[model samples]
Target chain A: MTASKDKEEISTYKTQPAEILAIRDLTDDTRYFKLRCKDITMNKDFQYRPGQFVIFSLPGVGEATFSLSSTPTRRDFIEFGIRKVGSFTEALFKLKKGDTIDIRGPYGDGFEMEDLRGRDLIIVSGGLGAVPLRSVLLYIEDRREEYNKVFFLNGARSPKDMLYKRDFIAMNQRQIIDTHLAVDEDDTGEWPYNVGFVTQLIPKLGELIDSENTTAIICGPPIMYKFVIQELLKLNIPKDQILMTLERRMKCGQGHCGHCAVGGRYTCLEGPVFTYYDVQHIKELI
Target chain B: MSKEKFPEFVELIKSKGKLFGPVKQKEKYSFEEIKDFSELDFDYQRTIISPKKFITPAKYSTLRFVKFGQTEVLPDDEPQIVMGVHPCDIHAIKILDRLFLGNIKDPYYAKRRENLIIIGHSCLPDDKCVCQSTGTDMVEDGFDLFLTELDDFYLLWVGSDKGLGIAIEAENLLEENVSEEEIQEYVRWQQERSSMFTTSIPSYKYLADIIHLNYDSDVWEQFGEKCLSCGTCSLVCPTCNCFHVDDKIMMNAEEGIRERMLDSCTLPYYSMVAGNHDFRPDRTARLKLYYTHKLKEYIGRWGQPSCVGCGRCIAYCPVDINVITVSNALFEEVCETQEVCDQ
Candidate 1:
């Protein structure tokens, strides 16, 4: 019943403190934080993938799972685009640079970047779903030659909720990637991009590129997936080729905690990123 | 030599480590640290809290951190023996073992789980027990010593070198060997006890199929309407392994201990994600998730169901919603519907 500590890697549930290096506000409720290792870097052994999430712990407040918004290509620091939702995030949102916060993981079996190589990538994101997808986008941007073509479709409710607005504009102007941005329920007049659902933009993918050769990835609200996936399926994208990231209250960030499980699959362990083919059997995936 | 010597055995085991097992607390039974051997009750209807609490604990600090400085993870562990654990609980421990010690090791759970000794108690079934149906009433290998209570004397199986050492230390209380006639009677007793379980699913193997086919089954909704979303069922379940971790500030306010407590899936916000995106927002979906995880999903992943036929969930649920009732309803209705489709 006893396992030797010498043989095993670092203990999986252990938490190490990380100091806040920088904080940049994206909206009234959301902020982008760049944190450097305070002591031991769990990141060294963690080998954190682009789409994986970490359990951010604020001493005296609580713990919450936040996605790694920063690309793994930048190994100097870990970054998160966190929105103040619950009390835990409210406390985290208040912290400034040089402040320390506890973190465990870089949990979840994240996106298989190797699988997307040489394939035409179509990335769709809604609201703050762009947080984790930012890691994916930036990662792919670094290895531009490895993939065929890239298309990014982003949707937000209004200018206030829009994330990475400046980056999207710059990436669109670069011409290497096709970027489409939209905002529904926008109160701000004279918006530059299309003002409708993101699903409306999928039709723009016209016969120029082959749907069979494309890998469509979606990260958005549960309500947004129905129409977006319907549009992707209409384009004849294979179920296996269409990947979607799922969100759940991941407490343990380990498989034992039933909080993050979709059906029997633990989202923290199996994925926060699961292919549509994998979720076909998994019930109540949102 | 007989039931009278049970107290002496308890004293012997208690000498080794902290003795924890089922003891009558008011009207119900629960596993607690035993100070007196006489308090140890071999017979009980069901323990309100499962033996899981002893192994994993409800709450514990995993780490400590201070302002702008070092963060230390506490890995200190203690050794203990949990005596008189029923076969069903032994089975639950096996599942927990696989989960904690498997591919991705949970150091928090592993620290306590290791250096733990379990003595199996081959118990007689009660009205609520469905371990016979689940095949968990009889465990092939989970304990060092398995004690089966006979009419007059206790039939003990020293299953390991550790068990044999304990038995040898107290050789004065035990008989050398049982007669062939007594052994046959023991086997008959096992058969008789197994026949007592009244609750059952149609078949454990078909449980996954039934759940898969009936994802939209009205039965879950029916139970969901009655469900208070209180999570009493999950709290009492031996195999329900959900938990929450948080950090608490010490009196100094400069330091804090990061702790973990058991959480529940039945909570309305269990699946709520960032930006207020809720996956299983309603009671019906949450309840569906809970049932499917036990019967279908866990079996798919772990090669075995999380349920051990202990029926602790059924017995402890305040609303009277039962897994056996729902499972039977789902299976019978789904099978009938399938038959109609075939016709």
Candidate 2:
């Protein structure tokens, strides 16, 4: 009972340092920051379920919630695929290694991996939505023997905006996960990947088309979600099996802020990842 | 347990400090000082708003920040008791309690809640009241003392030890050893008077199940047309605790205070982001969420509806778009029309 009480209290008061371990520029507007917990013991024990996000803060500058790109198994470090679109992210992009920041997290109901055991997994990501899905993919790879089949389809504005380049190549070479990448437009002589919308690849991925035990996880911009869900439904995936991650402007990672709520459900509490059937009727989610 | 000694109770509170009760202000009523026993208006259906304003005022500073090296913290304040709160308003206070005292407990609200004492009054409902529908007509907890008014005296139920102490201190005012027959008479009188009050909605449980069934129900569009988005309904609501934090700097740049003010979902900017994305961009969606959260989500999570049916929303609304009317319309739609609902 005391352990459960502590677990319940975990979501309330949280304080962790945000020491930057590594930084890599993904695009002109996006950067990947690898944050290592300053306290080694805290870092080793910091566990997060996939699809959960953390509130990243730069002192004096504001804080914003970002989906963790790192898998829970990798406790030594956590990563964030931040797009420099808002004031907070823009300021975050300027930070170098060894700079201190504030982090309070692993909040929200993450994807239920236990429920999907033995089922075929289909991951659909558009633009920078791959950040959260990356966590799920890594989790699956860590326990590869548990799942039946794995497939990944990612879409980006251009080849340059595509995240996790070396990681995608490594995953492809291992042949553990069937991976397909798509770009919106073809560069004159630079790129050689599939040049079309990400949803267009859904029909081509025969496993998702034929498998009845398939659970497709989708995360993207609002427009991307609508179009991708439409395509997945066309492919005859079960509504309850189709998981979609939602994005909202979150202040307090806790549900008290009321900033990230979609109708009755707080995106920060009930879900950032909700099955289509759960949110299908919630019109405001889209 | 017995008849309250009203005058002595008043004196006990007065000895502590000023005691606030319902005082008529011009045409509207507010929680103000009870100068004398005659000034107290127990018959008023509900105040223009809840007494939460005494704790978390409409606007107040929470934290003062100074760059003394690098640290930020809040300064505290004195506490007081609010007497004669209606049952519905007390229920609303309980809802705020859950929000503030839940997993992520808010220090600002907790500080005030811990120090304050609530003395609830049994409501005499008016035409617009639906406390029965929301199951908030009488409170079992969340108060130090609860009083049910009778002909010449008030039947007091002591809930907390503080209440017992207050009653004991006011020995001169109370008459002990009241007969069980008199207690039965008071209960019967309250029941008879309460039955006359109108219930805008039916059973709360049934209402919760079918409340959102009429999402596309034209009632929202109708309400939206009349709603000024002035947020009077949310502001006057006792359970509506949504707030926005802001920073204020004094004339001297050396010091600044961070404060949180009550915010309303009715405003277009309530859900607005930096990139100009407003989730509930439509007025209908905003209005629907307000009622759905109060009637459905709050009950679903806390096993009780957030609205106490104090009728402040009905009374304060510029166009009078009451929650009970909207909930009743949906209840009828779900039971009669057999329409599927949205979550």
lDDT of 2 by residue, B225-254 (tens): 777888888788888877766656567766
Candidate 1 chain B: 10-residue stretch with minimal lDDT? B68-77
Q: Worst lDDT window (10 residues) for model 2 chain B? A: B67-76
lDDT per residue as tens, model 1, A1-286: 0011231353465567778999998888888899867665344444567888888766677678898888777776888888888788877877788888878767777788888899888899998889999889888888888998789999999977889887888888886678888999679887888898899999778565688899998998788888898899898899999988888877777677778787778888778888898888665775
**TM-score between predicted and true chain B, model 2:** 0.90
The deviation in Å at residue B227 for candidate 1 is: 1.4
After superposing candidate 2, which stretches have Cα over 4 Å from the reference? A1-7, A11-14, A58-61, A208-210, B1-5, B14-19, B32-43, B54-64, B68-79, B202-205, B247-257, B328-343
Listed for every candidate in order, the interface RMSD values in angstroms are 2.6, 3.0
TM-score of each: 0.92, 0.89
Put down candidate 2 lDDT per residue, A99-150, tens digits, no spaces.
8777777787888888888988889998878899999999889988888888
